[model samples]
Target: MYSKGWIMMELTMNWITLRVRNLEASLDFYHRILGLPVERRFESRGKQIVMLGIEGQPKLELIEGSDPPVKPECGVSVGFEVASLDKAMAELAKEGIPVARGPIAPNPSLRFFYILDPDGFEVQLAEHM
Candidate 1:
């Protein structure tokens, strides 16, 4: 028999892994551009992997040389919180990374924009007002 309170299930996002074509380029985008520090890096099954994130937060894992190479899907993106969208855009401009989409504020408390990573993955940066 099933009861509403009988099942105990907890869900959390541990990490997101992406198979990248170029490790250094991806590293430049994620580590240098986005300023995410590399937490740890290691090799698994002959493939190199890098995890990037702030302490005690979900990680974004970048993997290179994985079997059955994968292409990033369109319309799928990873969003990040930014202190200021204007500052982020200026920094990106200095690095010559163009904005893929707008700094749209659909509501009173949100503004955001998108940029393409080295692997053509959509990276969204948002600032809450």
Candidate 2:
């Protein structure tokens, strides 16, 4: 029987894995284009894999594949937070990437913009309002 003293499980995000067509190219894009720092790297079966993470956030695993390039599409994107919305968007512009949206409030307590990643993923660069 369950006891009243039993504590509920807490929700936490430890890490995420992203499948890519090319490990080295994807790693370069993520690190050089997206500017995520590489925290860990590894290999398996002659294939390369790398893990990256943001400042103090959980790691993101990048796995290499041998497939055609994946195209980007709307609604298939991830989100990342930045210190300043305007600054982040401006910086992305230098990479020939444009912000699809501005620092508009998606909901209360937040300001964000949607930036299209290379794979058609919508990356949200957000900040607290």
Candidate 3:
């Protein structure tokens, strides 16, 4: 049989890891408030890690550790797509999470808002027409 010259591999993002000061609070915010399911929780190298996301989707890993010196606002914002921006905003308000900026329409077909997580990380929730 002739040997294949090359094989194509599909690549996709697995997760995004965030170093958190309060693991429990972060877990509550992401899992309870944002409605991301807990995929798993485990300890590694004496550090606690919580993975949150629905099955078949990219997971968000929250690791308990000393916070780095970098300010949360100094980097790119993490974006999440929501079914309805208004409903998401209402939920955020109900949870006492103030909107940093937002509900702005980038174009006719899209709306978005920004809110800070428990650690001051900016997260954008967007809705598309």
Candidate 4:
């Protein structure tokens, strides 16, 4: 039997996987645009997979799928924290990547905005005040 204060098993987030139609486009956005470094890459069952993240953290995996991949569900998004929202926004604008939604601050302590990835999945960039 396990004691009240003892843990039997610990859980942690491993990674988030996104199916992408164009691997080059996805890499351009995620690597060049957002500045995520590629952790590793491999192939399985005729499909290529690329993982990106910092050391000792959960990764973002992009799996190469069929051209014209299936549409992602509505209202699902992944958010990343930025040191400066204004700088990030400026960089994005320089790249000609339009903001799909808000640079809205619902509260004084937070500000955020959304952009669409190549596959039309929502990607959010936020900064804490």
Instruction: List runs of model 1 lying over 4 Å from the truth.
Output: 1-8, 66-69
User: lDDT value for candidate 1?
Assistant: 0.89
Ranking by TM-score: 1, 4, 3, 2
lDDT of 1 by residue, 35-105 (tens): 99999999888988999999999999989985543555745688999999999999999999999999899
**How many clashes (backbone N, Cα, C below 3 Å) per candidate?**
0, 4, 0, 0
Where model 2 places Cα greater than 4 Å from the true spot, the runs are: 1-11, 54-56, 67-75
lDDT of 2: 0.72
Off by over 4 Å in 3: 1-9, 67-70
**Tens-place lDDT digits, model 2, residues 55-89:** 57887777776654445642356677778777877
TM-score of model 2 vs. true structure:
0.73
Q: What is the C-alpha RMSD of each candidate to the true structure, in Å?
A: 2.9, 4.3, 5.0, 3.6
lDDT of each: 0.89, 0.72, 0.87, 0.89
Model 4: how far is 95 from its true place, Å? 0.2
Badly placed stretches (over 4 Å) of model 4 are 1-9, 67-70
Candidate with the larger lDDT of 2 and 3? 3
Candidate 3 lDDT (Cα, 0 to 1): 0.87
Order of candidate numbers by lDDT, starting with the best = 4, 1, 3, 2
Task: Write the residue-wise lDDT of candidate 3 on 29-57 in tens digits.
Answer: 99999999999999998889999998999
Q: Summarize candidate 4's per-residue lDDT along 1-129 as a digit string, tens digits.
A: 857553435766889888898888998899999999999989988988999988898999999966456566656677899999999999999999999989999999999999999989999999999
Ten-residue region with minimum lDDT total, candidate 3: 2-11
> What TM-score, over all chains together, does every model reach?
0.89, 0.73, 0.88, 0.88
